[model samples]
Target: AQSVSQHNHHVILSEAASLELGCNYSYGGTVNLFWYVQYPGQHLQLLLKYFSGDPLVKGIKGFEAEFIKSKFSFNLRKPSVQWSDTAEYFCAARSTGFQKLVFGTGTRLLVSP
Candidate 1:
């Protein structure tokens, strides 16, 4: 079984501020990691993912994450955030050959303009 942990429960920033949220997963074997964002009144959307190949994964809305296998971390980052980027971000992990996804508690981001 795989589990995820998000250290940042909440974050506040002004527009154009750089953002970084910590995410760690527990799983020794091959696993897939993902970052999902849920905006106000919107469903969860995929922000980025790291399955294989390069560890740095680029995603929509100027988001990116790097998978560090040794540290079991997949932290998300953005060069500059916008007010529209405010959302609840979740980190998830799924071991290979598994059918279920383990998710973190989620981090709430509030960007002020």
Candidate 2:
């Protein structure tokens, strides 16, 4: 069975602070990685993804992540975050050509101005 686990359930941050959230999965085989963000009152949108190739990938809103195959981790990082970045972040993964996705419970990021 495959599953995702987020280290934090909620986080509070001040504007312009750096942010990093942990994500790990329990899968031994190949898989596609993704980070989806849902802004306040908005639908989920793709922040970034890792299908094949490089381990490091960048996404919209100055976000990036590195996929560590050995650790079974894909952690999200932002050098500096703004209040607008406040939202719920979900780490998801699925096997190649798999239709369904397994998502983490989610980490709520609250950035204060």
How many clashing pairs per prediction, in order?
0, 0
The lDDT of each candidate is 0.95, 0.96
Query: What are the candidates' C-alpha RMSDs?
Result: 0.8, 0.7
Which ten residues in a row are the worst by lDDT in model 2?
Answer: 93-102
Off by over 4 Å in 1: none
* lDDT string, candidate 2, 74-101, tens digits: 9999999999999999999998788779
Tell me the tens digit of each residue's lDDT in model 1 across 41-108. Answer: 99999999888999999999999999999999999999999999999999999997787999999999
Could you tell me the TM-score of candidate 2? 0.97
**TM-score of each prediction:** 0.97, 0.97
TM-score for candidate 1: 0.97
